[model samples]
Target chain A: MSSLFNDDSLKSIAEAYEKYEKELVPEWLKKLPERMEEFNTLSWIPVKRIYTPLDIKDHDYMEKLGFPGEYPFTRGIHATMYRARLWTMRMFSGFGGPEETNQRLLFLIKHGETGLSLAFDYPTLIGIDPDDPMAEGEVGIVGVSVPTIIDMDIIFRNIDMSTVTTNMTINPPAPVLLSFYVAVAESKGVPRHKIGGTTQNDPLKEFIAQKSYVFPPEPAVKVAMDLIEWSIKNIPKWNPISISGYHIREAGSTAVQELAFTIADGIEYVRQLTARGLDVDEFAPRLSFFWDSHINFFEEIAKFRAARRMWAKIMRDWFGARKKRSLWMRFHTQTAGVSLMAQQPWINIVRTAIEALAAVLGGTQSLHTNSFDEPFRVPSEFAAKIALRTQQIIAYETGVVDTIDPCGGSYFVEWLTDEIEERAWKYIDRIERMGGMLEAVKKGFPQREIAEASYRFQQEVDAGKRVIVGVNMFVEEEEEDIRKVPLLEFNQEEIEERQKQRVKRIRSERDKARWSTALSNLKRAASRGENIMPYVLEAVKAKATIGEIMGALKEVYGVYVEPPIY
Target chain B: MSSLQSISEEIKAKRPLKVLVAKLGIDGHDRGAKVIARALKDAGFEVVYTGIRQTPEQVVMSAIQEDVDVIGISILSGAHIHHVKKLMEKLKEIGADDIPVVVGGTIPLVDIEPLKKMGVKEVFLPGSSLKTIIETVRRLAIEKREKEKLLT
Candidate 1:
């Protein structure tokens, strides 16, 4: 690498900086007193008032950041980026039963949502049928309940499975849900290879952040790999795993931690898949990521830029991946739900817009801007529409999409990107030294880190160090006194009763002999260390309920009991 | 004996105020529950937190086994009405009805009254300060102890 500045020139510049600081700073300080405060990023990275070439003096332009679409794509993965095509506005939508969720999906589609993201209810997420005793009140509460193949069919009833890409935010039971999607697509005459979307078959993050895990870590990851292996052969268009850092950030880890832990989990997944005799290039291209666009505007942008660069290095240098596509780190960004406040709900709109803009500047491939009212309940229709419009305004009106990585050459952005990447790499190194993410998780390293970060943040908020508009500073005397925000109401008892009846009907209506045979085959395959995907697909086709399939697997793999961390 | 001495004696004789912190139903979002657990622990309460996706029956059974002074249920999945109501019924069925239940999470304003009517002693919605939650739990624990003494 050619040096940007010679030794004498650099020394001259350093001397000049020292002279300026010594002479000019004192004069300026006397005339204009500086604000008496410590400045830092939301993640607590110290910030200086001004950034210059001195801050990035060590930056090797061609090595640290290359041309967009080149190796180590710090600028962006694609050369043209949004100039060629805008990022997909994939709004995450789901609530009540499949029918209701289907309507929401269509509503988003009608409002120019380019892609669909499905959020399964608690019962579905944890691999339980709606009628299960444990699933009683939770049915269709948080997300749509998909208990059987029929429910999945209803959810995607008229939507063309081949045309629209879908993303399912699910794990642990991801394979079962993916099997149902396949069954739905096949029944719709869509070819298996033509089916597209991603299932969040990331079990490691579930242990780290989201606690919707079913089996033990080893077996759960085995199941995730099973889906990845199956997707490589059959569903070429499908991304089998979306290694998620979104939930990690929501669970209160700093941006660097989210990046590192998520990448480490990706590394663990890659290791497991390669150990199963799969080629790195074959499965690597299908590996995608999910990230959170938190309120820290510049920090979030830097985090995303750093993520792409780090991922490229890991894939090419570490994993020896040769495919350029394999080296590209494609991710979906969701605005941080934890940043939304229930106090001044309307202010959340501004927060979401800023977060979404950061994601755009960060070069996300897909984005989901969270609704303002999400802190209270499921977003009302008006709120969801406004959230979608937030993205539209950024894309069409803001002109941010006109350029490719507009912030690429900014000194502050580049410096922050390097800093975040360095910190994240250190975390990755620590995890690697601990024998990787699984061991780290087993020792509750990430969990305790997240808990501590969460507690510290709460303390900051409570102590008035951090200002949350209406939460701590401008406190609302009474809810009624504030602007009336409409709440999304769902008839819980009605939804639950209808879901239970549907499950019961499906149980009675399906060919019991076929269901039993398929379930037995699944249980046998799960027990004998065979690939469980084919059997799971067969069971789904046989109309086996999610709980039944998960129950059989649970009998084999056993449930995970998380070690108490906090 | 002096009142302070008698109070200290009572506190020494009694077990620490045990609070069962639980997430009932399928909501895997337990950041609130976990935060509350840590805060209560810091405030000198022994908190037994059941991890996410716990059924109401499981929560009630655990509460009974732990013999908790308070049952703090955190539900962000928007099923608080159904879940908390069923939990209240389950506690009644098990005859552990004396335990005061405090609910927290993103509860709707309209549902707050109904949740309280379902025997939830307090409802802490989103943006509820940690100090507020801690103070509420402490006050509720004392009220429960006094009521138990009267019943005895």
Candidate 2:
């Protein structure tokens, strides 16, 4: 790779920078005091007062960051980018029962949402029915609860499955949810290949951050791969696994850790698929990523750019991917929910808007902007609308979408991209040395790293080193009245009661013989180490409840107990 | 040397405060709970974390077995109202009701009063500083100790 600047030009720029820091900075400090004693990005990367060509003197335009949609796609995966078609506005919507979540979905679509992102309740997320005693007090609390295929039907009622793409944010039981969705789509006469969407079927993240794993790591990964293998043959348009770093970042990893661990997880998935005798290009194209657009604007954008370039290189060079589409690091981004504040909750709107803008400039294919009030509770209808509008404003009014990779060539951006890429590659190399992400996770590498990062961040906030507006710095003498903000209210007892009764009714009404047979077949397939998707699809069609299907698999696979790490 | 001796004596004289940081129900979000556990440990308290996806019964049993001074419940799944109510019931049933419970997470302002009425001593929302949480837990532990003395 050739350097962008010649050795003489680099030396001149370096001398100029030193002169500016020594002579100009000292002279200016006499008249104006510096804001902070030390300035750093959120990831603890030291930030210079000003960036110049000296910062990126070693950068090569072609080798480091090629043109948009080209090899090692640092600029972007798409040539036209948003200039041709804006990124998908997929606002996450779910609360109460299926009916209520369905209503919210319709509301978002009516207000110009380009795609749908479903959030399941805790019970459904962990692959249990609402009626389970373990699921008591949790049914339909966080998101929509789908205890059976009946509930799935109700959730997608009257919606054209063929026209819209959906993303379901569930893991561990993602196969079960995917099965239910496929059954629903089939019932609606939508062909399997025509129905497009993504299931967050990444279970490695479950152990590392999300903590929603059912079986132990080895078996859990097998089930996740089952979906990927099934999707390649069955649902061509569906993304089987959205290897997510969003939750990892939300669980408090740094941007580099998020990028490194997520890409590592993606590599693990590809390794598993290809090991199954499937070609890499066949499954790699559908493998998508999910990232968090955090508070730091430039750092977040650079993280995305670096991630795309790294994944493209990994696919082409390491994995020997032949197709261009296989090398594209297509991703969906959600603005950091942890960045939202409960105190002066409205300020979260600004935070979310800024984060969304970073995601757009960073070249995300799809974006979900969290509502300002999300830190307190599920977003109210009004708040959800505002979040969707935030994305729309960035797309239509900002004029950023008019250009491709708008921040591709800035000195600071290029430097930050290189810095983040180098740092992330170090972590990936470390994980690879541990054998792979699965072994790294079993050894609690990422878990411990994330925990330490989280604690350190809290310490920074507590010690006032990091000034969180309305949290550690700005004082509100009197609490603002939040009564005016409309809150989403749902009767928990009633929702649970109705869900329980529905589950019972489905069990009683379904063909009992077929249900038992389908469940038995699922268990057999699960124990035999065969692909469980076909059996899961059969069980869903048989109206076997989520609990029953998961129960059968649990008998064979057993449950996972995460090793305690502090 | 005398001051250091006094500090050592102070540490030896009192039973170190023990707290159980737990996540109940199907909520897998434990970043806050884990952070609180570490912070309390740094503040000279013995913190026992129950990890994630723990049931209310399991949490109460752990509290009894650990003989914790306080129980801190961190829930972000918006299931606090249901989980906290069940937890309070379990604690009472186990006769550990004197062990004060401090709830934290994405708790709504509207639900705060209800949770407090249901015996949640303090509710910490998203922007709550670790200092505030540590101070509140310490104060609650002291109150609980006094209440146990009165009952005895």
- Note the DockQ of each predicted structure: 0.61, 0.73
How many pairs in model 2 have backbone atoms within 3 A of each other, for residues 3 or more apart or on separate chains, i.e. clashes? 0
lDDT of 2 by residue, A74-172 (tens): 989988898888899998889889999999999998999999999888888888988888888888878899988889899998789999999999887
Worst 10 residues of 2 chain A by lDDT: A477-486
lDDT of each: 0.90, 0.90
lDDT of 1 at A559: 98
Can you write out model 1's per-residue Cα lDDT over A1-566, one digit (the tens) per residue?
A: 84455677778888888888888888999999877578787778998877767788887888988889998899899999999989999988899999999999988898899999998888899999888888877888788999899999999977999899999999988988999999999999999889999999999999999989999999999999999999989999999999999999999999989999999999999999999999999999999999999998999999999999999999999999999999999999999999988787888999999999999999999999999888777788899999999999999998999988899878899899999999999999999999999999988889988888888889888888888989899887876622488877778789989999999999999999999999999999999999999999999999999999999999999999876556
Candidate 2 docking class: medium
DockQ of 1: 0.61
lDDT of 1 by residue, B56-120 (tens): 89999999998898999998888888888899999999899889999999887778889989899
lDDT of 2 at A485: 63
Stretches > 4 Å off in candidate 1:
A2-16, A23-36, A481-483, B1-16, B93-95, B148-152
In model 1, pairs of residues that clash are none
